[model samples]
Target: MNWPVFFTRLGSAIVFAIIMMFGLLYSHPMAIIGLALLIQFLCIREFMALVAKIFPEAYFPSWLTMLTQVAGVVVLLSVPLLAIIPGFFVVSFILPVLILLVTILQKKTALTAGFTALAALLYISIPMACLITLRGGAGSFHFAIPLALILMIWMNDTMAYIVGSFIGRTPFSPISPKKTWEGTAGGALLTIAGAAVWGYFSPLQQYHMSDWMVLAFCAAVAGTAGDLLESKLKRMAGIKDSGNIMPGHGGALDRFDSLLVTLPFAFCYAAFFMVHT
Candidate 1:
């Protein structure tokens, strides 16, 4: 292991963790929503860049990128404001309708812009909005759910790397060749175990050990899939990292890929749990 690279990654991760903690655990709901919006923009930017690289022949106008980002931000904000404000419901529909109209107006790059924006909306924007919804809105915001999700993903990733480095031999997938079956298994097991420990000791009495374990299972398995999905995109684009925003960690998308996919699955389960219980 290159010590310099490792230290760089560690340094960045510390900063990232601090930011995440502040964003998720902040007293106000807007903090996480703001952080989520920033993440949405960055992820969409990197994803669009990747798509551009993947399909060089396609014409990608800069305005569409801006529109997509704006749309995502508005949509995210609309979630918390929907109940509080009267017009927020209409605000959500306006942007999507505008997106369609804009795409229709572009005769040459219509499909390209439409689909790309659509994908970014679905891939980045919607997941983040789900995150906010999962966290609860302005009036009823609580951070534990999203915070635990992130912590479990971090734990799974860290343990997987350590375990894979020491004893991994079997390749986990072609998309991310560095990953190994041993590492993957170890990560999942440890994530579940860690969740169990948290559930056992956590003062948050709302959830039990089984709940934590299941959520951790979602994070580990879905996080792995998220990483591979990004890796596959990079491989197809013939690139190593998504962007250089975070030294040694690629980009925002690279960092939050797990959360994007994990949110939907975790949210579904959490929603079900809340409804059933």
Candidate 2:
């Protein structure tokens, strides 16, 4: 363990936590939405850069990437924007078509390249949309739920690294050579246990113990999958760290990759099954 490096990362992480709390826990919903949109922009940009690097032969153009970014933001915010702009939803609905149309006009393997842009747009946008949506609806959106989700993800990620570092023996996957089965299992167990405790004592009446446990499972298991997915992309792109936005964390994608996949599952569960408070 390199003590100096660990301290640097720890310092950076603390700073990150403070900023995130302010962004996510702001008094106004619009403030939170604004922060999320900013994140979406950074994440999508990184995703595009990775795709471009990985598929140099795909003929991906700059204009299309920008278009996808716009579409992604518009789509993610469409629900909230609906109340404000009224026309926002229509723009969100049509942007994808426009993106595809622009792609097809390139006339040579355009569809394949277009797929990359579309993939990036959907992959980043929907989860973020779910996050803001989590704080919405007439009592359906629970503030505590999103906070819990973020906490669990951070816990799972931190514990995974610690457990993997100390006793990880079996390689979990080839894509992320550093990860191990022992670490993954250990991290998940801790995260689930921690969530269960949190649920039992959580002041928020909306979500029950069961809900917290399920969400923890989502963060641990699904979040791990998300990390692996990003790792796979990085491997394909032949890079280390997606981008250097944070001192310790690689990029917006690196920090929130777990949240992206976890959001959909959490959203589905919250939207359909959980009894709203």
Candidate 3:
């Protein structure tokens, strides 16, 4: 085993656990927003680095880009001040367009600018907004849903690695060479088991076992898709990792890829079931 990688992963997990504790205890909207902002900024930086590698001549000032992206987040997160639905639309859709227009006028590479801005908006901000929405709502169970999603993803990833190492006969995708069909099945089974265990302990016992099972399955599938999508991007950029910020993990994007994809679905599930109930 690689000690360096092991220690790095341990440290990262500690920090994540601490932050999640804070979010759970405080239920402070701003704290969740702050964490989301930090993630968005880091993800955007990693994406910009990749874009720069692809389009060396592109002149996207990092600080300015960061500021705009963060501002957009602030605007989006303040949805209750106006109407959340419209605010979601503007921040998730319109802000990216406006940023792209500015980048185009600045004579940056259209393709790079467009992709970077759009990715920043969609990949980072949208899911984060879902988290914020979850945190703001009633019931501690809402928060548990996100936590459950994270746990399921971790379970899936761990099972996939363990199973893939031995019985992995079929590649899930060339983009993610290490992923396999056997691994995926093993991971899904493990995730379902984990979800059942979690549901047993959860304070909210209103949800049936079937509901928990479906949620776990959806989270596992979405998380895998998210991981594969990022792998594809990194492969296209000819980069080994998205960024060096996270020690064992490649970057914020690498670490939170599953969360990014799963959060939206989690939010929808919670809204439709838990919130309504």
Candidate 4:
């Protein structure tokens, strides 16, 4: 292992964690929204850059796609779900139509290009919307939900890496060969234990130990899938890292891939239980 690279990565992660804690834990509730939006923007940009590099022939309008993503986020954040649902339907189709029109006007015939923009909507925008919704859903002055969700994701990923490095023998998947079942299981167990411990000390006690364990389970599984999905995308793109945004961590997408998928599932679990019970 490259000690220098490892230290660089570790240092960067520590700085990021401090910033994230301050943003989510210390700042106002609206800071979560701002942070989420900022994350969404960076992730979308990185993803778009990856797609463009991988599929140069694919005629995707980056500016328009970014605009559409921002528009979707705004609608979801500002409007009620009832109104947003119908608006999303119209907004969804409009992008593809615009893509087609742009292709025609440019004299390029790439119908599949539109799908890239749509994929961005599903992959990045929707999950981010879910995160924002989850943050604001459980009533006012409750930023802890999002904070806990992030902490669980970070812990799961960190533990999996540590456990996998030390004792992981069985390869987990072809996409992420470094991952091991042993590591995955160990990480998950630790995450559940951590969640239970958190519940014991947490003043809010929004969830019981059982509930926290369940949520941790959901986060671990979904976070792994999310990590693999990005790996697959990167493999297809023939790239080692998504971008050089982070020295050892690769890019924004690389770091948050797990959280991207984990958030929606965690949000659903939180919404169903916390809102109703």
Candidate 5:
């Protein structure tokens, strides 16, 4: 084990997490939306770049790519805005149509390009949008939800690696060679336990214990799947890291892969149990 590399990664993660938590919890609404938009832009950019490597000829024009990026940002911001102005929700549908129409006009890789655009919209944009929706809390801002979700993900990944490194023998999946069933199960248990402790003291306790437990389970399971999915994509793209944005952590996509899936799942779980109930 490279102690230097481990420390570098830990340091980078701590610094980055601080910035993110501050933005999510203390920043203005527009600032939070902007940060999410920035994340969406970067994730979509990384995803497209990776896909481009796999399909060389499926190249989109720079203008088209830029337009799609702008649309993706708009879609992310629109989710929360919709709560304030119901009409803003239309952008969600309009952006996809615009992407399809523009790509179809390209003539050469119309089908592939259009499909890729829509996939990015669904895969990257929507989840980011859902994140803002989670924070919005029916037009009011609540810092605890996103903060707790992120903490759980961090705890899950950290404990998974620790447990896996110490006693993991069975590989969890071929996609991510290092992951193990023992590690995964142990990590899930730790994440749930940590969340239980957090909920007991934090404002999250306002919700039922059962609700927090379900959220913990969703975050652990769906978050792990999301991590593996990104790993699969990286394997397909034949890359070690998505980008060099974070010193130790690969890229925005690499870091937030779990959150990408976890956010949407958590939102749905909360809606069904916490919000609706």
Candidate 6:
């Protein structure tokens, strides 16, 4: 455990927690949406960079790619207003078509063009939409669930690294050489313990124990899968990190990969179990 790296991560976590606290306490849906948009934009940019490296002939300019992505986000954010009107599907379908058309017009390979657009839609739009929709629920559970989701992800990540450093003898994947089964188990245990503790002491106590346990388990499994999936993508892309945006951390995607995967599940669980109850 390098002290420098540890301190860097610790400082980053502090700032992240402070920002999240402010956002949740203020109960500002737009603020949450905007922050999520920023993350999505960064992740899109990183994805485009990876895509460009693999297919340089695609001539996919970063600026243009970002513009297209932002447009998609705008469309997603305006879904509520657009829901009252007709032709929403037309707009949604048209945006991706336009993205593909632009890439093709640039003489990019069909594969690159297809992936670029799909990555933006899945990696950015869908996850951000899940978060925004969850926030709109605006129930007492809303803020707690998001916070709990974030904490569970952070706990899993931290414990995995710590335990892996000490007792990791077996690699989980060659793509992420640093990951280990021991670390994975440690992280899962810590994640469950943390979730249970929060369930008992935090405002999350308002929920049933079974419901909270299910949410925690979903977060743990999804979070691990998300981390591994990103690792797989980066390995295929032949990149070490997603982006160099975060010091000591890799990128927005690196930081929020778990959240990206876990949030949808959390949202679904909340809707099906908590909300329906």
Cα lDDT tens digits, model 4, 1-277, are 9899889999988977876776676556566666667777778777877777678776665465566565556534542343536565465456555655664465363444555655666677767766666666434325677777778888998999999999999999999889999999999999999999987887875557776777788888998899999999898889988876777778889888988888778777776676533
**Model 3 worst lDDT run, 10 consecutive residues:** 78-87
List, residue by residue over 60-147, the lDDT tens digit for candidate 3: 6555467556655754475433453555545545566677777777654555665676766666777777776776643444566666
Lowest-sum lDDT 10-residue window in model 5: 135-144
In candidate 4, what residue range of length 10 has the lowest lDDT sum?
A: 75-84
- Backbone collisions counted per model: 0, 0, 0, 0, 0, 0
Quick one: how many clashes does candidate 5 have?
Answer: 0
Cα deviation at 161, candidate 4, in Å, is 2.3
- Show where candidate 2 strays beyond 4 Å: 1-11, 83-90, 137-139, 275-277
Report the lDDT tens digits of candidate 6 across residue range 114-133: 55766677766777766766
Please provide, for model 2 over 1-277, each residue's C-alpha lDDT reduced to its tens digit, 9 standing for 90 to 100.
9898888889889987887787677878886688678888989889988988887877777687788888888888887777778888888768888788789788686776688878877788988888888866324676777788898988988898999999999999998888899989999999999998988998877668888999999999889999899989999999988898887668888988888989989988888867465
lDDT per residue as tens, model 5, 201-254: 766545766666677888899999999988988888899899888888888999
Better of 2 and 4 by TM-score: 2
The CA lDDT at 74 in model 1 is 79
lDDT measured at residue 212 in model 5 versus the true structure, 0 to 100:
68
Those runs of model 1 whose alpha carbons end farther than 4 Å from true positions after fitting are 1-7, 138-141, 275-277
Please give the TM-score that candidate 3 achieves against the real structure. 0.85
CA lDDT scores, all candidates in order: 0.84, 0.84, 0.73, 0.73, 0.80, 0.73
Every candidate's CA RMSD:
2.4, 2.2, 2.9, 3.4, 2.3, 3.1
Error of 3 at 109 (Å): 3.2
lDDT of 1 by residue, 1-277 (tens): 8999999999998998888888887868778787898799889999988988888877777788888888888777777787789798688778877786778677775667678887888888878987888777533324677888998999999999999999999999988889999999999999999999999998877777888898899999999999899889998999988998899988988889898999888877877774322
Candidate 5 at 55: error in angstroms?
A: 1.5
Instruction: Quote the positional error of residue 20 for candidate 3 in Å.
Output: 3.3
Q: Kindly provide the TM-score of model 2 when superposed on the true structure, using C-alpha atoms.
A: 0.91
Query: Model 3 shows how many backbone clashes?
Result: 0
